[model samples]
Target chain A: MKLPEPIIIDPQSVPSLRWGIIGPGRIAETFVAATQKHTSQRFIAVASRTTGRAQEFASKFNIPKTFANYQDLVADEEIDAVYISSHMSDHFEHAMLAINAGKSILVEKPITYLPEEAEQIFAAARQAKVLAMEAMWTRYLPQSTILRQLLESGDLGKPELLTASFCADNRAVERLWKPGGGGIVFDMGIYPIAIAQEILGEPSSIAATGKVRPDGMDEESYSLLNYESGARASLTISGIATLPMLASCSFENAVISLGEPFFVPSSISLKTKDFYPEQTTWVDESGIAGHEGLSYQATWFAKYLSEGKLESEVHTHAQTVANIRTAFEITKQIGAKPF
Target chain B: MKLPEPIIIDPQSVPSLRWGIIGPGRIAETFVAATQKHTSQRFIAVASRTTGRAQEFASKFNIPKTFANYQDLVADEEIDAVYISSHMSDHFEHAMLAINAGKSILVEKPITYLPEEAEQIFAAARQAKVLAMEAMWTRYLPQSTILRQLLESGDLGKPELLTASFCADNRAVERLWKPGGGGIVFDMGIYPIAIAQEILGEPSSIAATGKVRPDGMDEESYSLLNYESGARASLTISGIATLPMLASCSFENAVISLGEPFFVPSSISLKTKDFYPEQTTWVDESGIAGHEGLSYQATWFAKYLSEGKLESEVHTHAQTVANIRTAFEITKQIGAKPF
Candidate 1:
């Protein structure tokens, strides 16, 4: 039994988009650097609220334009699209600003804090006839495409259970404990929840428990999603410890394990449940190690824009809404203050 | 840093007891076979509710006597101890009968269906001046001893999180779906719950969700346990699918993983979280494979009986009750019918 090769659109083959980046933080840096290095995407302008952070980011990336505020960046006619990489709390505002300006947008994971906000952003984007997509880069990775092919091939049969966790020690991040700041749920929990949504669709119900800091930020959480087909996904996220970030699904015929750091470029192993079971492992040889894989989403976004699509078919507007809705239910059940 | 060696008492050094078995089931065969082969423990009699079953088991194990009724087996003056491997629903009745007859007893895991029943069984044993221990054989494994020592030595530091799962495709086991059959909670769930109790102590609160069979038995479940010290354990159990049966604990200084099939003789890996992390893996070299490891608990029971202990210190009576109580809560929260 062989795993199928990923059908990837070469980055250079896709139309390049002149992009403006909002919120020049660490993730934004990775997005800009990786996209420029690996894809034909271009960064025309950079924006940051802080006085010179925009220029500093622009200088490092050799971008020609810089804006002190996001408004000017979105209004720039030279920018074809905007990548919103601000704090999760500001994703809705910046995404709305980009959508209203008729600029195609690629927002980071958790397009907005609330599902309703995501709906509003997509609604405005639809009205403006501009493409909008959540930069759920994991979906665009070559390994993920291979996984999708395997799932669609029906070799594994029906999925019965899924277990995934995203945990790390991030106690030093002060914003994580603040009111508008995305707590563990939005910041880290979205990965497992998004992947679960991608695999299981929308869950019928969610049961969750979590530990919250005195300041109302959740430090850790566990959410159990029950699907209509009786498939369950047990997900765990923590900001208090470093755990094995592994994800696996138990199907009727085999178990598929997405190797450690499952959200990144990793290996996939399929072990059949036959009497004489055969195990096959496929490792991502894309050579786009770590966050460099972020370039996949950038290139895909450019291709979607060139195709004149209103939303990404890979990580759709509906999926972004559903993922955040699941996260919302988890936050509500855990009794944490919502972002 | 070296892992601690297990301080195991030689089974031959402990005073051997003339044993009478209640419930001549598959597990009982394993218990009798492993104990007789590995330890000085001797089985004098066997009993089953079915007339020929006792005689069959007795003939197979080379026991001297057989009884169709448990009363006669417990009343046998030569029998010093009774090994109750009855169905979980009958554990309380069998254990109480053995305890009331002034016979030491080693009941199977999940000593009883409910915490109250376990309490009654332990109370009867206390009044009868006899030893009573839950056959939570995992605690007696050599790797478990090393895990305990690592936690006690302040090398792993304070445990912050635990994740464990005991899942398999047990749909063919008709008894698992029947009322009073113990379901998934009392059956496979006890393993992870018992280990969690050993490591994290009693949880202050539990949140759980599950899928129940049409017959009202739980087929799968997920539980989140919160401790007063802010530590947490996430546990999952299933009767519908075969899953990765891995257990791990995240501590302040290191993360320890009990390799697959963790409830039996397996490997232990300790990876420290220092600037330069060190990983050490230890495999059990005792050569006691699988069900054969059941003998360790029997031999330990013999030693505890010789020491005149009313309950095992390794898996205390209170610990058994607490573990059952946690399972009870899970069943209740998941809306499964109680056994």
Candidate 2:
């Protein structure tokens, strides 16, 4: 059994969303660059703690407006949605502010460091009748949908185990070791952990073991997730060790080896028992490449907002909170410094 | 930096030992079959609980003598060494018998399933002035030597993580669920755990989580071995799920991916930082294939005996004990039935 051709939705088919960038940081630049390059979405305003930084970002992105702080960006009536890419610790406050302002949101991966904070943000969004999503852009990629379809099709049999790791030499980065929301688990480990949750759902039990940096933040961590169905996922992420970003889902009769850096628009290979030695590689063919693939989520968000949906179906508000909640549990288990 | 060429020692160059078989079981058949087909070592006698079983084994292996009991075989003056392949529960008694009779021994793995038992067995062998070894045949395979050499070369840099799993669908086998030394962890998990200890040495901490059969043996297990150097090994084994037998060592700058069924003579791929996109695969040209590769350990044992060595230098007796101790810890943690 082969995966059906992925549903190729065109970015231009969705209604355009006027976006405002909050805390115009590094990831905000990539988000705006990708969305503007490949989608019908446009960033109308940029905001930063420093007026000069906001003006510089607006000048570079050719935005018509600049805000000295995130509060003003969420207040702009011309903005249909806000993209929150602030420092990790500020995600909850920024997201709550945007939700209460009645602006739709695409907060960066984590959504926030704690599940309770994520829950509050989503609740606020619901009360305001606004759209909210975690920018786990990988979930919206074409490859991810095909993977879900393949899994749901029962071609791979019962998914028994998933092993994934995402690590990099990021120990020198200051933001990764700050007082709050600073650590590899929040910044990097979340990718593998989120993907594991996406495939395996909630784990009945989890065991986490890891190392901490001199500053007491998590440096490297490994987690074992056990489910009632006997399915397990071994997830590892590191800041001090440069590990190959590999993700593989092993089912009863087949295996899906997602290529390195799986949380991106990359290729995937399937090896099924029926085919034995024969493996089929599925290419993304989405044409949008690299971080530009971030456009898919913006396009998806626009479609949901146009349909008056309060939350994304692909990555539900509940799933996002659960994912962060699991991360918090792992962080606590490893005795990682928390915000 | 590249790995040095693996030091190859010819099987035929080693002196042959006159060996006796104890218990005459399934793996014993493979051992004799592989050794006789590839090396100069000779099986002089066969032993089993029944005279008929011993006779049948002797006839198949062209042995001149057959004994109904292991004690008689160990006492035979013509037999210089004993190969113990009895049930896991009988290993300590069988090994002690051979050691007291002044015969060298090569016992099947787990070397008694507990660190204390292994320690006693080795101490007796040392006092008797005879060679004693656990048939961890994978350690003697050419591919294993190459992996060790690669790690030692610093080509891959400091080894930071190791991941391996060996799972099979053999739960229905009665011995696997029986009272004495029965369980997936003892019978199968030892392979991955042994190799993990091989790569990471003894871990400072180990965390295990999994399910148990209604019969009380471990149905599945996952272990995280944490080293003080911050290196870690994630090992998994199951009796219910048939997982790909994979072993990989991740270094700071590169990775060594030992091909599937890593506990065999197989290929290995090297991926380095400098040659990020270029992965080079080295195939096993040792010509020893399948169960026939078991011949390598027989040859190695004969060489050590001829050199008047009481133990193997490659895998020290202390390391073997530590490996079993870790397995015992994992088994207890998972609440699996103990022998």
Candidate 3:
């Protein structure tokens, strides 16, 4: 059984998008870098609460315009889309600002601090008749596309279990331990949970245990998601230990192991006893390594907008809501409040 | 910090023992093979329900005597130690028989079908003034000893999370599905649980979920063991998926990863930022691989007896009981009845 190749399209063939960057932080830098290098998406403007930060990011990225605040960029007529990379607690406010301005939007992961906020943002996008998507770049990677095709083909049999972990020593990051937009679950944990939701759908039951700092932010969490089909996902996130960051899907006849930092354009290998003791490692040679894979999502967004699409095909609005809803359930089980 | 060397004693220097096998099963064969190959321990007699099976095993292992029933072998005066490798359900009966016959005993993992039964056997042995232990051979291996010393030294900081998985495709094994001595938790899950207990001690709470077959045996299971120190263990077992069988201990300063089939003599590696990006993979040069490592336990048991020790220091009776009790808790949470 051959795994299908990921859909590849030239950056020149895709219609270019005039994007305004909201909140010029570390992730926004990567998004701008990926688009500028590999895609037709153009970051025409940059916005931060301070003009100095916005101007600095604009000069660094050679963006055409800079706005002191997000509202100005969202209201700009030249901006066709707004990519929200603000702190998670500010996602709802920024997304609402962009959607009210009738610009298409791509909000970063966790969509919002809560599933309800994501629902509100998408609902307003529906009313505005504009494209809306969570920039879950992992879903748009070549390896993820190949993995989805493999799973859909049933070549590995039915997936019986999946395990994923995303742990790093981010304890020194104050925002992670603060009350708002703080915690491993919202930042690091969401990736594994999103992947599990993508493969197994919503869980029938969830069991979770975690350590919450004295300030009420989650230090680490472990969750077991049990599906109706009896498939289980064991996921963990930490601000403490340095984890391998590997993800694996086990099926009746085969197993697929995604390499370290699995939520990226990394290698995925398949092992099965069908050829007993032989494993096939599928290397993703997209020439896009690490965060550079973020470009694929930008190109996808541009192509979807050109086709007048209102939602992402790869990460649907429903899937985004489902992922956040599971996060809510996980936090609830662990007794941690949403930021 | 340097990881300490394992406390190794020459197998040839250990005192010899006259062993009698109460059940000539597959595991019993490995025990006989390990002892014969590496230690001065002698297998004097073999016992099985069938005379033909007993005689065949005796001839293969070059034993001096064969018995159709366990009663005759245990009652034999020449046999000083008896290794019980029968099904889990038969452990209590076999252990009692050996204890009553004034024989030093080593029962295979899970010691008995129930923690209460293990307590009973140990109590009887104490009254009879004979040595008794659970042959959790992983504890006797050099890798396990080194891991223990590392944890004890506090060089890796405090352990905050441990992950272990021991899964195999054993659905075709009928005894694993039958009422007595059945299910993944009792058959395979005990190993990970034991190691976790050894490292972190007993947990304050446990949460578990799994799939049960039509016959009520567990097909797969996942558990979260939460300790008082806020440490957690994520464990999994399966009669379904083929898991990596790797075990990891994550601490504040470093991480220790045990190679696949961690319950065997295998390589262990240490990862820490102290060396920055360099990871030291400590390979086991014990010259024991796979089930051949079972010999280490035989030599350990002989040495303990020669020193007139009544219990294993590495795996005390209390620890054995604690391991079984955790298994009971896991089975209860998964709603599987123990055999």
Candidate 4:
């Protein structure tokens, strides 16, 4: 496939970056739609492991280019950034290839097979002068940013414990259950881990044990991590059973508890000893998009890129790596079978 | 000390069960009042290390006897049962003495220093033909019983995640920051742990970490535990901070959320997810108890005696032992100075 001319959002003014998705998964689709909607970013191309599937997705989405090979799509100079949303294991090689090709990249959470692998990809990105980041997305969300602000203001008092669980029975998503692709500790686990790292920092000790299933992949994993300051985090992730999927950080004086779907709670409540705690609601900020609550990450990503920022302090590379490291150690502790 | 004449509810009833208070503290005053209020129980004596204090408490409470030594109180035939609410380190000795005295015993929440000690007391109870149980009153509370009923009827769907936190600063209590006691995990943590165990059974694996003060006692503890069935419980307890000390259990379908002072919540809300994906408060059961919730535990103890039940199924000795064992293991893992 040949590189088509870049579709410029503001051709006569500032140049817009072209974004090509490497997989037609749900997240990739969401990313494409968001990019297509955002003028500062362009959804110019997409690629799937299967050419026919890629073409079908391209046709459905009305994209100009689609390729069967990831390497080919990434090599297309018209595309300045590659979004890798395939499987957990595929992340390392795809990220390495994109970094080697000098294209900036964003890989999904639990960015690599192991912490070492994440470090390798990061090193490659650094050595190659190409931007790379884990697509945590949640860190950039409005609620999360607000939460960070609340955390910084010292109003909640000294944070003592942060507990988070992100559980989904995605055994339904077979690609996840397959070897080297997906599993509970990698697929849904990173969200809670990342959230913990956001609030509690890197844990000094990690003790995790859970059922690793007959198929040799973790069906569910629970980890108790201790931070150096004695701050603690309990992270739970599963593909075996469904749960409330919550995130909570307890302070010395009070607590801030986020409701269901820790990834995107419809509402989060700040509660204390005061009688009857109610959730504070946020009015949607006027924007080009309709899903304001859901769109903050992408908008932040665009804003970060346009502003020439290296990384966000709230969701830094170190914390993302720390979160991934904790997940990796927990998976090993649970004896996740080698693929 | 001479035995006081039996105070029986009925002549045909069994002889009044004599009782001795191990700690002549504020709690002893309440226990004496309760024993006076209860028919089948007698307030035999009060004991303190200081002879003056012991006599002072006895005179103030109108007890028939006072002992400067706990061993003598435990040995008294006039005392058929022993209530232990002393410093935690003394519990091991006090309970051992009471058990040896062939007395029915009510040890506080943490039955002893560890699982083995609690087990020993259980075995002693069996050999001596005397009843022994952890004084976990929250389990016997009417609201907690209702919550258990709601849980059994599948009113909240499958039990999922239990988030319970109990935190209280003990600046008001003397000698609370001792090596064997005074921190949150053992002091305020037992109720929440018991509640989780009642709802979810024994966890197969547990990971816990907490804040240890300069004295090496745990000021805060956070634990993530996983049961065999993949149910998760995230529990946090602290002693250095002032918190609502509340608890809530989230299930697959609904959440059983409780209010502050979780040893007893003012209200419990059973929230179910509506078709709109919003939580509907299905049942909000809340109100002021005529008194503190611990009174419920005491009343339940009296009722159990009246009913001739050897062990309470609600807060069974076995369940309490198992939970304390978990707490003991957690304290060990967190290296909280054996407190």
Which number leads on DockQ? 1
**Better-scoring candidate (TM-score), 1 or 3:** 3
- DockQ, candidate 4, vs. native dimer: 0.12
For model 1, which pairs clash? none
2 or 3, greater by lDDT = 3
Which digits, one per residue and each the tens of the lDDT, describe model 2 over residues B1-339?
454566667878988789999989888898899999888999999999965999998899899999988888999999988999888889999999999999999999878777899999999999999999999998888888888887667666677878788766565677787767567888888889888888889999988887886667787888888888778888878776654577877777777778767888887778763313457787887677766778888989999999999998888798889888988999889888758
Worst 10 residues of 3 chain A by lDDT: A271-280
Q: Which one is best on TM-score?
A: 3
Native-referenced DockQ of model 2: 0.22
Candidate DockQ scores, in order: 0.37, 0.22, 0.36, 0.12
- Candidate 2, pairs of clashing residues: none
TM-score of chain B of 4: 0.85
lDDT of 4 by residue, B171-257 (tens): 455465777754567777777788789889999988877667677677777787789866787777766544445566656766666
lDDT of 2 at B271: 73
Q: Candidate 3 on B1-339: residue-level lDDT in tens? A: 666787777878987889999878888898788779877889999889965998999999999899988999999999989999888788899999999999999998878767898899999988887889998999988888888898888888877888888777777777788877657898788899988998889999998887776656788888889899877888888878775677887888888878667888887778873312347777787777788888888888888888888888899889998988988888888888757
Q: What are the per-residue Cα lDDT tens digits for candidate 1 across A90-127?
A: 99999999988889999987787788999999999999
> Which stretches of candidate 3 lie above 4 Å from their native place?
A1-16, A34-41, A127-129, A213-216, A273-278, A283-287, B5-8, B34-40, B127-129, B212-216, B273-278, B285-287
Ranking of models by DockQ: 1, 3, 2, 4
Q: Can you list the residue pairs that collide in candidate 4?
A: B267-B286
Among all windows of 10 consecutive residues in model 3 chain B, the one with the lowest summed lDDT is B272-281
Greater DockQ among 2 and 4 belongs to 2
